[model samples]
Target chain A: MNPLKLVVVTAGLTQPSSTRLLSDRLGEAVTRQLADEGRGVDVHVIELRELAVDIANNFVTGFPSPALNAELEAVTAADALIAVTPIFTASYSGLFKSFFDVVDNTALTGKPVLIAATGGTPRHSLALEHALRPMFAYLRAVVVPTAVYAAAEDWGAADAEGLSGRIARAAGELAELMAGRPATSHATDEVIPFEQQLAALRAQQ
Target chain B: MQFGIFTVGDVTTDPTNGTTPTEYERIKAMVRIALKAEEVGLDVFATGEHHNPPFVPSSPTTMLGYIAARTERLILSTSTTLITTNDPVKIAEDFAMLQHLADGRVDVMMGRGNTGPVYPWFGQDIRQGIPLAIENYALLHELWRKDVVDWKGRFRTPLQGFTSTPRPLDGVPPFVWHGSIRSPEIAEQAAYYGDGFFANNIFWPKEHYMRLIGLYRERYAHYGHGTPEQAIVGLGGQVFMRKNSQDAVREFRPYFDNAPVYGHGPSLEDFTEQTPLTVGSPQQVIDKTLTFREYFGDYQRQLFLMDHAGLPLKTVLEQLDILGEEVVPVLRKEFAKNRPAEVPDAPTHESLLANKPDEVPVEAR
Candidate 1:
C-alpha cells in the first residue's frame, strides 16, 4: 500500500519558533497515530519565513518561482495538511495567510486540514475559528474538528488541559480523517478536456 | 515558419528621460514601426486593441488599413481583437475590408480582452466573458463563411438574412488564430474550428504555455484537423538585443526596471530566466527562441514584442533592424532545418483560398 502524503506548513517567523515546535509535535503525533492504524505516511514540511520574498513576488508576477511552484505542488498533492501559524493581532500571522493566498483556490478543495496556532496568550485561541477556519472553508477544505492552540504557558504545562493534550486530540482526528482516504495523486494539474469544459459552461447557462 | 512583431501600443514615458510622447507622436511612431517591419524583411506586424487610456490602438483595423496602404508585403494582423465586447458584425466587416485593402494580407487573432470595465463600456457584463467569446466568435465565424446568415444566441440580437459587406478577399476569409494565455476552452475553440492557436508566451512561464499548447495540439488532432505535430501554433516572445550581451542587459535594464505590466516585479535577470523575455546578444536571442519550437513542437508563427516599456522610438527601430537583419534570418533557417514536412505553414489568405477552390467566387474561380 502506498504511504499517505502529509504536508505541514509552518508560518513561524523565527528560527526556533514555538509555532513550528507545535507544528512538529502535531506532525509527529499524527504520524504515530496513523502508523498505529497500519497506515504509512510521508511528511513534507514548508517553512514559510524562507519563502517570504517568493510569495510577495508571486503576488506581483501572477506566477510562482520554481521553488514556490514545488512547494505549491506539495501542498496540493497532500492527502492531509497540518497548518501551524503564530497568532498575531488575534489572527493567523500575515505570512501564513499570504502563503495560502498564492495557492490556487481550487487546489485545496476537499483537502483535510488540521488547523493549529501558537500565541502569547489564550485570548487568541478563537482566531483558529474566526480566521483560519473560515479561510479554509472558503477554499472548501475539510478542516478537522479539533483545533489546537498553544499559549506561551501551555508549552510548559503537563496536564490534560495543556498543549500536549490538544495536540494529541487534533493529531488523532487528522489521522483518523487521513487513514480512511487513499493517497492523493497530483492529477489536479491535468487540464480538463475541452468537451468537458464546454459541457460545464453549457450546463451553467 | 513566419517571424513578426506585435505591440500593445502603450504610451509610456521614456524611462531614461521623463518625457512622454504625445498621443499623436505615439500613433505616428506605431505606423513608422510597422513600415520599418516591412522594410527590414519581417513577415508580419500585429497591433493590440485597447479601449482605455495609456493604450492607443483602440481601432486596429483603421491603423492596419493605413499601414496596408504604406507597406507592401507585410501581413497586417491584430495581436488580439476583443471577441467578448465588440460586435462580431463589425469585426467581420472591418477585417474583410482590411483584407481587400491589404490585398489579402490580413488576419485577426480573437481574444477575451483583459480589462474588466471594457466589457461594461461596450455594453457587456464582465461575468459573461467566456460565453460572450464563445457566442460572438461563433457568429463571427458564420459571418465570414456564409454570406447571408440567420443566427440567434444569448449574447447578441438575432441576425436574419444579413450580409456582412466586402465579403472576404477573393471569397476567402482571413485566417484566424485564437490567442490565449491560459484558458483551455479557448484552445478547444481554436481546435474546434481548425484555426490557429497562439500562446501569449511573453508574460508567463513557458511551462504554463506548454500545457495549454500541448492540450491544443492533442485536441487539434482529436478534431481530425491533422496530426498533433501538424497543428498550427503561434508563440509570442520578447527580446532586447545588442552586439554585446552585457551591453544588451545594461541598455534594457532601465526600461525593464520600471516598465508597466511586469516591470518592478522580478529583476530583469530573473524575469529573463523565468519568462521568455531575452536581453542578450542577437545570438543569445536566436538560441533562446529556437528552444520554443522544442517546447511547443513545430509552430507556424513566431511574433516578438519589441516595442514596449517606454523604449525610445529610435531604440525600437534599431531593435527591429537587428531582429530583421541578424536574429530572424538565422532563426528562419534553423527553424526550417528539420521541421516535419507534414506540419502546415502558417495560413495566409492565399493558402486558405487555394485550399477552398470550390468556394471561390464565380469570376475568381
Candidate 2:
C-alpha cells in the first residue's frame, strides 16, 4: 500500500508569520501520529507567500508562470492537504486567497482536506469553519470534522506539553481519515455506457 | 514541518557596493528564490501583490500557475488577495479558473490592503474599506459556494444569476485565511465566519496581536465552532540568518535601515525588539520565534521573510539552505515536544474531510 501523502499549505507573508507556524505544527503533528499508527507517510508543506509575485504576474499577462505550474502538480498528487492561512477582514487574506484561485479545479476532487487558520485574536477562529470549510465544501473536497484555530493567546501559553497534545489530536484525526475505508466506487462507474452494459448483460447471459 | 520562504518584493540598493537591482530584476529574482525554496524541502512559497511602483506582484495567479508546472510538491499561495478594490465576481471567476489549472494545491489570504490610495485607482473609497471588505468577501464567498448565485450588495452590482465555473475540485472550494495587522473588525469578521485568522507579526509588537487573537478565540467559542483553543491560527515573520550571529546582523543591518517599508523609521535593534523582524543568526531567530508561543499559544503555521531587502539571488538561496538544514529541524523538535493532544493541531485536507457523516443525498433527504 502506498504511504499516505499529506500536503500542508499556508499563506503567511511576513517574516515570522503565525500562519506558517501553525502550518508547521500541524504538519509535525500529522507526521508523528502517522508514525505512531505504524503507517509511513510523506508530508509536504507549501508556503504561498513565496509564490505570490509569480502568481500575481501570471494573472495579468494571461500566461501561467513556470513556478505556478509546478505548484499545481503538487496539489494534484497529494493524498491529503492541510491548508492554513491568516484571517483578514473576516476572511482569508487576499494573497492567500488569490493563490488558490490559480489551482486546477479538479485537483481537490475527492481529496481530504483539513482547514486551519491563525490570527491575532481567537474571535476569528470560526473563520475556519464558516469561511474556509465552506470554500472547500464548494470544491467538493472532504474537510475533516475538526479544524484548529490558534490565536495570539494560545501561542503565549504554548508550552511544549500544551503544543504537543494539540498536534497529536490533529494528527490522530488525520490518521483516522487516511485509514478510513476507501469509497467503493471507481471512476468508470458513473460513466457506464449503454453498449458496455449490454455487452456485460450478454456475457452474463 | 511546514518549511518555506517568502519575499517582500523590494528593489533595494546593493549595500556592499551601493548598486540596486531594478524592480524587474528584483521580481524575477523573487521567483528564482521561490523555486529554490521548493528545492530545499520547503512546503509552500507565497508572494505579496502590490500594484505600487516599488513592488510588482500585481498578478499572483499568473505567477503561481507558472510555478505550479515546475515544482512537484510545493504548494502555491498568495500573501494578499485584494478584497477591497477588486470586484468579487471577478475574483470568483479568476480563482475558479486557477483552481482547475493548479490542481488543488491552492489557498489564499484576503485583505483590504495596506495602500490607502489603491482604493481610488479602483474606483472605491478608502473610507469604506471595511464595508467594502465585508461586502466583497460575502459576494466572493457566495460565488464560490453557490453554483448559481443572484447577489446584490452595497459594493458590487446585483448579479441576476451567475455561476462560477470550473466548479471547485470535487466540490471543495479552496481554503481561506483572513490576515490583518491593525483591524479588529477584520478579526471579528473572520470569527463570524469561523475562518482562519492570520496575524502578520512582522511590524507590530506581540501585545497588539495578542489582544486581537484573544478576542477572536473568545468569539470563536461563542459562535460554537469549537473551543477557542480549537481555532486555527497562523503568523508571519522576517529573518536574516547566517552561521555566525554577528555576521548575520552585520549583513542585514544596512538593508534593514535602508529598505523602503521600514527603512529609516526605527533602529534595527528597536524594530526587532518591538516587532517579529529578527536579523541575526538562525538560533536567535529560533529563540525569538519560540517565545511567540509564550504570548500566543500552540499555533499551527510559521513562515519567514528571507528574500527581501534587495538581497541577491545567491544570498537568498543560501538563506533557504540554512532554514531547511538547520533552523527548521530544531524548531520542529522543540515545537513537537511542546504541543498538547487535546488542543488539536491545525487542519489538513485529510483531517478536515474525515468521517464526514454520509451526506444527506438530495433525493433521499
Interface RMSD of each: 3.2, 22.2
Instruction: Compose the digit string of candidate 1's lDDT tens values, residues B1-365.
Output: 89999999999999889989988999999999999999999999999999999999999999999999999899999989999999999999999999999999999999998899899999999998887888788789999989899877777778999999989998899999999987888998899888999999988899999999988898889989989998999999999999999999999999998978887677888889999999999999999999998889999999999998899999999999999999999999999999878889999888887888574567885
Candidate 1 stretches greater than 4 Å from native = A186-205, B359-365
Q: Candidate 2, residues B1-365: lDDT per residue as tens digits? A: 35565555656676767877876787778778878878877877877878887677888888888887787777677777888998887777777676667776777778889789998999999998877787788778888878898866665667888887777665666767788887877777777777878788876667778988887777677777788887767788888898898898888888887666666555677567657788788889889888978888777777788876667778888989988888888888898785777666545444444633566689996
List residue ranges in candidate 2 displaced over 4 A: A1-205, B353-365
True contacts kept of 1: 0.35
lDDT of 2 by residue, A1-205 (tens): 5677788889988877888888888888777777787877788778788887766754543334556667777777777889999999998888877777777666788888878888888899888888898888888888888788888888777575554556566667877787663532323213222234334433532
Per-residue lDDT value at B133 in model 2:
82
User: Cα lDDT for residue A198, model 1?
Assistant: 52
> Evaluated with DockQ, which candidate comes out highest?
1
Which 10 successive residues of model 2 chain B have the least lDDT summed?
A: B347-356
Per-candidate total of colliding backbone pairs: 0, 215
Q: How well does each candidate superpose onto the true structure, as a TM-score?
A: 0.96, 0.62
